[model samples]
Target: NEQISKYAVQDPELEGMGTTCVVVMLKEKEVFFAHAGDSRLYLLRNGKLAPLTKDHSRVQEMIEKGEITPQEVLSHPERSLITRALGMENVLEPEIGQSFEAGNGDKLLLCSDGLYNMLSNSILEQILTENAAAQDKAIRLVQRAKDAGGYDNISVQVIEFQFKEQKIILPTTPLNFFEKNIDESSENISPTIPKVVKEKKIVDEEKVPKSEVKNTFQPKPEMSEKTPPAVKTGKKVPDIALIVLLVLFGVVLTLFFLGSGMTKDPKPSELNISQTPDTNAVAEPMNEEPLDNQQETTAITTPKKDEKPVTKPEKPKKIPKDTLISYTVQAGDNLRKIAQRFNMKTETLKKLNRLDDNEIKTDQKLKIKVRTVHTVAAGDVLSRIADQYKTNRELIKKANDMTDNATKRGTKLIIPLAKAE
Candidate 1:
């Protein structure tokens, strides 16, 4: 309303360009009305009339405030003085009438003050109570007001209402793209108990022979807006017979396979193997070499002419019952020299000391748990020393502390020295 007032009544030159009365009504279950000035809205129900809008004129206000009685209002000079009217200024505050419950056969009448002023309430009720249509009632009411010397412009509108159930019907046409796709998918479904429609669209079941069994389905004789869509069924009698045949064939094939897979037990001689692994056919290697090369290797190792067969140096006898002695390596000594000085075999000395070779360094101490000691005599060589001690020559050399095949008189030696085991 405020927004309308801001933009309305743009013509300032027009003075007193206002209406004395105006009324508007919208029809629905709840009827709505709007009024400004001295208009009226009346609802005729069960032979009684009720006002839905109030007059905003000066005389009406005077009656409301008890300043004047209802009887004096007809002749009141202020009766024509309306307090409100549209287009009188830039803004209007029209009264929004309270809604009324409307129903079938209900009549709503709207009229200006001129018509109501010329006619009495009893005449208005008698006109509305007549058994006539809305147009006829409205015409009679306006004509009666004019007949009573109406000096003002009169206006009237009458509306009669009725309510009924409303239904929206859909068109019956061929299925659309989406619906056809759905139908195709449902048709392709292969249920074992698929529903089947018979060949006949109409069936007179009374005439069917009692001796003949038939699966019958009936179709609608006509199509209409209210008719439901026809149900598309599968192949009729052939599908059932075909399904039965398929089941029988599957059962027979299963039994045949079971019977063919069984047999009696057999002896070993009746086995179907083509050959045995013991035959040469499968034994010979694909890449065998000659034996001549191996024989030549032996010949080369034998060393022909005056070359003697090399034998490993023997280890000396065990040192006397685990007794050992320690010796300090001296200058110009090797493992052989140390073994000779300790009266042990060179191989035995190397094994006992965990030596890598005959190499020895000066001033390094070697441990041997001493069990016995022997002293070199004037006539004693390493061989004689070992023979008398029941040991080898290298043991005598090691015992006598000889680095070479030499002997010295009065040399103290560890006879057959052995490391701690």
Candidate 2:
């Protein structure tokens, strides 16, 4: 009422005007209603007419509690007074009603108090049950009230639900792109049940046979906005296969480095003397008589001797195991602290991770690879060192240059190490 009164004072067109508004939304078998003022909603199911909406007038309440007889209300001098309306200074609470299933022959009638004040249920039910169409019946009901001397303007809306015009709209939830795609990839498509309607429009004749089992296959609206779209579930597997291929390629590249030392030996064709002719040697004509040249061609090939093959020593074939140094995550361990702990450059950590800047969060793993050099102590033998490293004793001896697998105390060794498994 505060809002309406403010609007009435502010707006010229709505100055003294007020209204009773009622809205009915029908979905599937249920009907929901919202109403204000003395407007009424009535339902005629089977042969009985029932009032589904309450009139907000004071006299109606008195009559409902049996304080006043129906005859007295029909002729009461204060019956026309409306205690609640849109333009009041203070608006009272409105009534919102729950939905109920409407039967095949149900008649829903909505009307202003001007129409209901002059007519009763007997007059309403006869017009509804006579197979009168809703728009036609609404006009007749309004005229009947006006014919009985309506002092006020009358309005009525009659809605009839016939079995032939039935349509059931299934409940639907909003979906994003991916979810909609996933739902469509499923095999089951839930069918929509047929709804019951009273007056069937000629355009809706094609929708009739769905109630019967004869035409079970009715065309449904597409899932896109044009129809709601179906979800696509088949795209993920190809992505997984591409990831596996990339991993396999990485393994092949790492293995290629493992065979680098094996190709160091020179080929035998490079050592052959005949295949490697001396291009710089110039041949001069021999100063000899023609008869002597013909007598014996004692052509002295000077020092055409076989040169010995010089074999280069191959490097020791020890698989390079990277040294493993790990720092336990601690409080206040930033990327700078972690880099400084291993005496590594901060840029190296960022480069290893392909990060633009040195940004490391707490508890994140950082691998530090460096040269492993350690000195032997009194308690440390080759066997013990090998055990500590989880490696064989021979490897420790080879690393330290101890021929007999014996190491003196305080002897430094270059140990090729790895992270513990």
Candidate 3:
């Protein structure tokens, strides 16, 4: 209210211009809100609708005083007369509601008086509890209000709470050493069992009596000495092959280095032959030949004294005209801010909006006179673009809000043009 009053004092045309405000903030599972005037907030939980705010209007005061009932508010002529509103006083008090916990599947509705005045509470509750998206519910509510008798501007917002569930996964148990060995040996026995286990089993069997031993374990036939030598030969084959590969690789590297050295050695010799005329007799004649050929070419291509030079006429460029577009005022927007966004002056924006002062409200639609947009291309400078459009370079810079002459390729710039006669 203080901010609005300051603005109103600066512009006398905005002295009586004020609006009702309702602000709601949702953080995690909590809702916080504050409001003035007849704008309201509602909550729908488990198919039950409840009001979260009360209107600060004359009708509300009368109802509190027991002079009028709730049903009589719809037909009351003083229902629209708000006792509290923004910009109405220098020092004002707004009703700040307490924070409330929200739950999953809960729906919240925030709207202006235009909506509730046109539609009843029962209709609003039905719309809030509908099985539809939030955007759809808001649209339906506004459309219903407009259909009924939307003498005032209708605004509505719907929010639904939905929490997601997370899943947790547990790891499996690991196998023991003996169990792992047994499981692996089920497929193949000899290679899987450890040598220590085999030795322990044999020693245990020896301690048992001869009659009780029962030959439970069987031993495989022993490998001959020739088989060991063949195994050593198999392992040594890869070593011999690796040694041969190393020798071949070393030879290739040596050849590569030698070839590079040979290529480099001739470059210095060629440069020396060209630089020193007395060093090579053949190089001196080759260098002098191009000089004589250049003199002959220059003598042949000289222009005649009587020949006239021809020039072509330059073509004119087509200047782009300015266009008009519709822009909607958003929350926290002012005339200066909106004008700066489109690279325009505040006075020009006010003229387009047909406003005597810099007062604007949320969701207000205004006309914007957009200038010609030029996309910067390779080799495009501010001066060149200005010359092409027959305008001043400084004007172009100001229209595009440029701080310096530097313009990057593909950057769209607004070109301010003179008003068409």
Cα-based TM-score, every candidate? 0.36, 0.37, 0.39
Please tell me which predicted candidate would have the highest lDDT against the true structure.
3
Cα lDDT of candidate 3 equals 0.54
- 228-332 per-residue lDDT for model 3 (tens digits): 211121212267756655664453344334333432112111110000001001112222323213343443455578976555788765665554434545556
Residue pairs with colliding backbones in model 3 are none
Off by over 4 Å in 1: 1-13, 20-27, 164-421
lDDT of 2 by residue, 1-421 (tens): 4466677558643443457655566654466665666777777777666677666554564565455565565444334434345553232334556667665667788888666656666777777676545666777777677566554456777777654333433223232322456666654432221122112121211221111111112222122444223344332337765665566445333333432332211221111000001112122223433321335456544444585555689874333334433232334567776554444567776665455766554323345543443444445556766665456665444433345755543334444333222
Per-residue lDDT value at 333 in model 3: 72
**Cα lDDT of model 1 overall?**
0.49
Q: Which is the winner by lDDT between candidate 1 and candidate 3?
A: 3
Give the per-residue lDDT of model 1 (tens digit) for 51-129.
6666765556556545666656654433445555554323445555555556545677788865676666567778887
Name the runs in model 3 displaced over 4 angstroms: 165-421
Report the number of the highest-TM-score candidate: 3
